[model samples]
Target: MRILVRVLKLLVFIMLINHLIACSWYAVGINDLEREDTWVKANDLKGKGTVYAYTTALHWSITQFTPASMEVVPMNELERSFTIVVIVSAMVIFSSFISTITNAMTQLRNLNSERNAELVKLRCFFSDHKVSASLVARISSCIHQSNKLTGSRVHSEGVSILELLPVSLKCDLAEEVFAPTLCAHPFILTWSEYYSRESKRLFLAARSSSLGAKHELFNTGQVAESMYFLSSGAMVYVRGDTRPARVSPGQWLAEPAFWIKWKHVGHASSTGKNCELVSLHCETAIRILSQDASTISGARRYAKTFAAYFDKQFDQLSDVWADVEVLQAMVSEAFIKHEKELLRHSVASRVVKDTKMPGLLRRMTSRFSGVSMASRLSSEEGMSQDEQINLILHERVRKYGVDGQKRREILGTRSMGSDSSDEVLAPVVSPVFRNPERRQSIGRGRFARNGLNVVPGIASAFRIMTR
Candidate 1:
């Protein structure tokens, strides 16, 4: 059908061109009418009178033989009418052709644009998909190996710890820590079985460093080849000799800017207290993370979540680390599984009476929910060393049990009251369970105390889970 339409259009265009050419030829022939009076006078025509009379009679007869009335019309008037009709017809045809061409061109442009956009979107989608798939595969492989190790009688707890530690740190502590924590997790068991036959092994170890020690700091101006996780003491983050901030045990350094070739923007120095640190090289970490697409995707997702949590906690910890009220608020709000439900139920009317609450609560609830969900997923799937460390610091406060809570209380109080030390260290507790029901109840109770209700989406998610 399309081909036939194109053929018809082409034929019409050719016919129009031929008609125009014929019109042009006729116009050239008519130009001689202007010079007719100059060549011969009307009175000096006695010899040609009879011939002229015959010629005029023949012309009249020919004109009278036409379909319409043969009244003699002025040549100029007839010519003018013919020219106007031809011009109007030509204009109509030209306009129709132009409009058709314009519409077709517009459709073609739109199609091309859509195709290009789809291509771009497809490329990005596939890239992410592939990464996600690879990560899953690597994790699966690691799990399989862990299972085999578990089958063996060797202590698997150490292997598990090794799997969690970064490559550089693993090499440093293989003899001391990695061999002991092999059976703690399934991942550990798998790793042990895989490396049991090998003579060389990897592990992580920490040693205390003297305060004000002139230890080499990773140059922030250069690309970070490794990341450091402080196990004990403190390290000062400096910008050219000026101490901007101090990182203590359980805190991590190094931004996840390696994917885009990012360099550190500042320098770090040891605060010289008895400090223990675990360092992981960047290339090894990338290689490990990139082994599977799923793992990478999982890590990336978790990274965004971790960053949010860190930023929030960092803000609260800026002046003092011992503010108990701040600590409770941070801990309680860390997971959004409950808070969202409170907000959802609170807003009953379809029409919003309070405009500010909706937007503000929605954002806050999303951040809380998103971060907690990301962390839970990351822990289940396993993550890179830096990510694991950050997760432990931010989410593992409960590991220390009563002691941990006491330490947190002290830090909170100190933060609210005094600045005795440049850096403060405390173990953050990880929540016992991520059950939606439990979270919802907690969130609702908190909201009731504050005189707010849960939002709809959060309420829905929670209600569905509870049922």
Candidate 2:
């Protein structure tokens, strides 16, 4: 469009120059042709008279001509023709310029309208996704508190609100209620690492389904086209003859649909009015990932880790069990669900010991200690997965925080029990201070500093005892 406008302006400029030159030439022709000598010669033949008798005196000659007169007549006609041509050219160029300006204005108006339309579409998108004003404000608060571009850290010094709650309630707070809001946050999409944001947002952009009371999300045996995120209201997954588990908000449903199976095992339906769900179709998610360069770069790195984890869990759990719950349990322990059972047994063995006491006493003590360790593990296993993850995240975000190495070591070592041969050993130090002269000097210094003969006295007592 710009190029076309430029071309049209250039053409109009050329026509204006042509019009000016033609007018100048026409003016010069008129002035030269109207000079005294030219005009007198043009009228000289018109002044000639002929004598005649009284009867012929009244008769007039209608036709008369001279060479100069005939030439002037043709010149006048030629000048008029040149003037008309110039006027016509000027009019055409002027009209074209006006039309071009009109067209340009019309185009600009349309472009503005198009931009407004796009803005409206985006507003509608946010609305349809249930991104309300309060949700936006919550996201803003999270961003403000973190003051960081990445979700790697959280700034609040407080413990998680649901940290000590029961498994079901904690899951409700962390996974169902809290997580959906975080996933929907725009900053999480725009400011986090590319793959991190894409993986999250791809699911966030799923098509929304608004359901009234008792509407089903999917039926058992239905081909698994998408996995759903419940944004608002309540839903339940019902298996035959079983009381349905309440589908918590912010939780992913039918996750097996995305990977393990092509069909749903149980029927999911809304239990309340105005239930809102967003579903991520497998094909759409893959296509989005493929189109983005940043996501593609990290896809291989994270995908393999996730795939291995998923397959391990799938193999360990029964088909009738909920995959999401199993996944949550696996994440909390940093191990698969089956491994947790093994780890629990290992804990029991570590706590119970073979001692030199009476047989019945030893058995009683062993039994009690074993029960204690087992109970501890069971309590830990009961924590909600989201709560556990938040704890890890909180630890990671605090500056100058340890890597939870002590916790890991305690768990790892205790799980292996006393009989495990793979235990790591501390490095041995040489006994340079064991030399008599050095040992005496060190002991004397320690005694002097303390104003007590404690070190020297202890050394003397040890020697005497050994002797």
Top candidate when judged by TM-score against the true structure? 2
Instruction: Tell me the whole-model lDDT of each prediction, alpha carbons only.
Output: 0.39, 0.41
TM-scores for candidates 1 onward, in order: 0.25, 0.29
Clashes of each: 60, 1
Model 1 spans with C-alpha error above 4 angstroms? 1-212, 240-243, 257-260, 295-297, 303-467
Tens digit per residue, CA lDDT, model 2, 1-467: 45356657766676556545434533434456455343223434324432221111111100011112122221355555654554565567556766776777787679668857866785687678989898766654543333322222221213455356665553343333334543542322221223333344454345555565665677876767676777778887876677777876665675443332235657888774547666667556545544432211222212222223433332321112444432322232221211222223334443223353323223223222233434444468666433333333233223112423432342331211122331222121111111212234433422211123333321121101000
> lDDT tens string, model 1, 184-215?
22222322332332211423322222222434
Instruction: Determine which window of 10 residues in candidate 2 has minimal summed lDDT.
Output: 58-67
Give the local distance difference test score of model 1.
Answer: 0.39
